[model samples]
Target: MSQSVAARPRSLWRDRNFLTMWSGQALSQFGEQITGLAIPVLAVLLLHATEFEVGLLNAAGVAAFLVVGLPAGAWIDRMRKRHVMIWADAVRAVALATVPVLWWLGWLDIWHLIAVALVFGIATVFFDVSYQSIVPSLVPAAQIPEANGKLESTQQLAGIAGPAIGGWLIGILTAPLAVLATVGTYIASFIALCLTRDTEVVAPRDEHEPLLRSIGEGLRWVFGNRYLRRIVGTTGVSNLFSTISFTMLPIFILRDLGLSPEAMGVIFSLGAIGGLLGAMATPHIVRWIGEGRAIPVSAIGFSVIGLFLPVAALAPAVAFPLLVAQSFVASFTVLLYNIVQVSFRQRITPKRLLGRMNASVRFCVWGVMPLAALAAGGLGAWLGVVPTMWIGAIGGLVSAAFVVFGPFWAMRELPAALEEADADASR
Candidate 1:
């Protein structure tokens, strides 16, 4: 263990390749957050879209996970991840830039926005699958937790600035011009990716293998493993309910509460600080409580905090603080859950299977988001926003039971290696 520890890279900050990749991803994540706010606000304000339309728009943006997620993993496994990422970024940049250009031409419409969201989401699916697959090669296995923590921290930090700035931009420049910021960020991300170099060679694969067979291999590997199966259940259920709540959050905050765009931005920004804190604390928490234990605890904690969202509807004065508190605590626990889970997935999976494994996991986790958004939208349209949120929050709280009752909760510690875990399982 000592020798293994000694062989690991001590500091990610000192590595130029990692830094370049991290910088590009940081900018890209921040850009995504900006668009996240700007797009929905644009739909509501400029297009005068109904709650169901807004939900549909959000669903369209993430629908690619269900569309191309499986094949993307198989295809990416056969190519250089860095090159795939670079092209993905370039494509997304061009796609997003069209939005602002069309708006400036006074030809922007809901269909145009929908087209852009779908195209951008397709690029994002490739980028995300490649990104997760490449990280383990960039750092040693022992350092994965630290690396993931740092990456999560960067994401949280971007979440802090992105929405707040997006909100302010939307307030001053309106939603159309606000999207231009993401265009610049994507361009910057492209440049950052261009500067980095990947030292690892692409993993070898059979040239004649059928694509369907390759995809099936990934699916079998993920579902065949007990640990991953439980993770899928936990993540899928939680994401389903979380998306339901968030799908209508814009209407609740901006329309129902009558909050200004800037104020709404501030609320989200302040809430993201909890995520940053969680990232900073993860390594210590893992050491203290063990990784296996942390998962259920975080999941349950997040659910408990989520209960506050529906309660926040009592009054405007009561709503602001309670909503902020809910966001803060929920973000914190979610980050903690994600950091450990992602690290564990990376650590356990072999290099040749990383892309497929990540993709399969995402397929289960994110594919449900669009469905949940549509459900929430339909419910919000029929039952009203607050009632929809109530169902979402309660459903999310209950989903934690999947983890609490699963194999993960029974283990005191995660196995040190996948082979050892497999051996124990077989015995």
Candidate 2:
């Protein structure tokens, strides 16, 4: 264990196996960040896709969470999660690398880009399910929040740097070739995954049983639990509303505001700095405010404050600042919310059901996000960009009410007392 990890007793970072896992995850996140920009640029610049087509590309990615998430989760529950993650990363690297290769061969096209997107999306579903499921075995319950916080921080840092780098590469090398940088990140991720060692853990036995029954059991556990239920509901609604605005932000900036691609990259990267700060601070905030209250408070604030993005139309000079501010608040709030939710789920779920449980909830929460994106795009085409944004902002505020009206708002703290209660219940 490293000295920093050792300083924090009972922390996951102190565990050698989890340290390896976190390092691998962090490395992979860098590549994941580049893809968010590179892939879209490929579609828009190289393939000459339309606005609806761009929306379709995003929708296709989210399709995996809907179509394959449940079954993939169940399948992963029967396998070695670490290996699953490694293979997933490897597949993604190869798929992303194909873009550059095909471009060189003069074979790059919109359909090919879409195919790669779908494949990458499927791989992500598998990796995410495995990663979430395996966290419990990597650390003690007390360390889950800290582990989640650290992971969130790493992801935020990737968000901060990846787009800027991608934009720079695109400016110099073109969009297709810039994807090679993303591929390099995936390669690094794969290498890190190879170095990681995991302590042996048991797989779920329910895979051999009726598939529907097994899936149902996992769903029941997540939804039946009061805490998880509230989390799923709150996040799902918030995600739906947030997706509306997020889906159109790029279009608004690049098309409506006439910002250069480089400027868009800089804006995203700068805003991500706030995300990094938020993720770094999340553990402290949780400790101070308690997980229960802190988590929902951030969610509400993120959604409500998101409304201010449209105010940027008042002046183009302030547009970047407004966008950055929205990104800052939303990223911070979402990261904090994820920290609490992921840690709680890992702590409460049994190892046997972790994969399915993680997937089931994610499916419910994120499956609708793509459709929301499509709706945003269609609306943006029909109504103007500003009007579409207005709709999104209103929807986001209303979605925050899910948390406000729920029992999540009533729980002002999470402490050793709740831990003891969980211990007693588990026994």
Candidate 3:
């Protein structure tokens, strides 16, 4: 029996439900990559948007994380996560499809783009929260790490191809037309998710439970733990400043640097290679340094590398390579930190609280993005691009202190809770 058990391959490859989700996610991520570039490109090049206008557009895309993120988590825990995912995908497809239509009608404006982004972002909050929460239901505890790596690896691959494709498509068909391509990818994802089978066993809940109470429970659970709370604070602070810097990229790169769409695509695609390598190398890094130690190291490394973004402005001739280099190193470090922390969080949380847990985390880490986008717009206008970037670079560096001085420095193994859960799953 032991030999037979050992002979069988232990992998998620044989799990149809997991495969279905992965396939859909891969396609969706590819389309999202296009949207990531296309929208900003459209707002910058086509609409001739200023720094403040671009910041508003960027802010719209992420504001939902703060507005509806908490409630979405509470609702997700009470419903089938897969069902929520399918609906969210469908909504995103519909919302994105409008960009091309409005443009064709000569009605496209920055406001239209912002409105679409806001709606799409709202759906994304639900989809993303459910997506992460559903993973435990798809695979066992021991498989969580492998599943995260695979998912992150493929997402990075999409990051590699999506920008290049989006740029080429924008050059040939125009920015609005490029959106249609993203719409198609989302439709494909919607169909794939419709076919996915979910095995989540919903826990009994009082239907009358106040949504605020549920949200509060998740909030308390995440905040009650010192380690988790610090991680949240670190990520939240880092993301705020990172957005301040990134919000200026489209304006500065296209206008100040005079780079073409094709060059822009190549830069982003090549830069994402760092994330791919990081995801692939995460297991090895964790094994060598352990999770707790890796967190602070990765966090500090990325923050330090982020300073390079501003350095590129000093020498215009080498700006392109410098920009790509900064992106590469930053992405690599963020991925290593993210995959390790996410897998650790997944393993430790109980199944019933996964939705709220993931949601609460997102609320802290991602919630700052929109606010930062607005801040980026104002600061970019007031302080000028390089000065604002300097502010972000300096501010972001401080986030590393949270992990470097926290409890994880001494934690070389899983806490007792996660270890017990892993043992239970093996049986």
Name the regions of candidate 3 deviating beyond 4 angstroms. Answer: 3-9, 204-208, 416-427
TM-score of each: 0.95, 0.91, 0.95
Quote model 3's TM-score.
Answer: 0.95
| Candidate 2 residue spans exceeding 4 A from truth | 1-16, 204-207, 415-427
Q: For candidate 3, write residues 1-427 as lDDT tens digits.
A: 8988976646788888889889989999999999888998999999988889989999999999999899889999999999999899889999999999999999999999999989999999999999898888888777888999999999999989989998999999998989888888888888888888877987667553688998998887787667677789889999999999999988878888999887888889998999999999998988998878989989998889888888889999999999999888987899999898888778787877788999999988899999999999999889888888888899999999999998788977656485554453344
Q: lDDT of all predictions, in order shown?
A: 0.86, 0.77, 0.88
- Model 1: lDDT equals 0.86
Model 2 agreement with the true structure over 84-186: per-residue lDDT tens digits = 9889989998998898899999998888887888899999999888888776666666666677777788899988988898788888998888888778777
Ranking by lDDT: 3, 1, 2
RMSD of candidate 2 to the true fold?
Answer: 3.5
Error of 2 at 146 (Å): 1.6
Candidate 2 clashes between residue pairs 3 or more apart in a chain or in different chains: none
Best by lDDT: 3
**Is candidate 1 or 3 superior in lDDT?**
3
Per-residue CA lDDT of model 1 for 1-427, tens digit only, reads: 7987877666888988889989988998898888888988888778877888878888888899988999999888888888899999999989988987898999998888888989999999999999888887788777778788888999999999999999989888888888888988888889998898876677556462688998888888787777777778888998898899988888898889988777778888899999999999887888888889889899898978877888888766889889889889999999999998888888877787788888999998999998998898899899999999989898987768878887776676776688964564344
* Candidate 1, superposed: residue stretches over 4 Å from native: 1-8, 204-208, 421-427
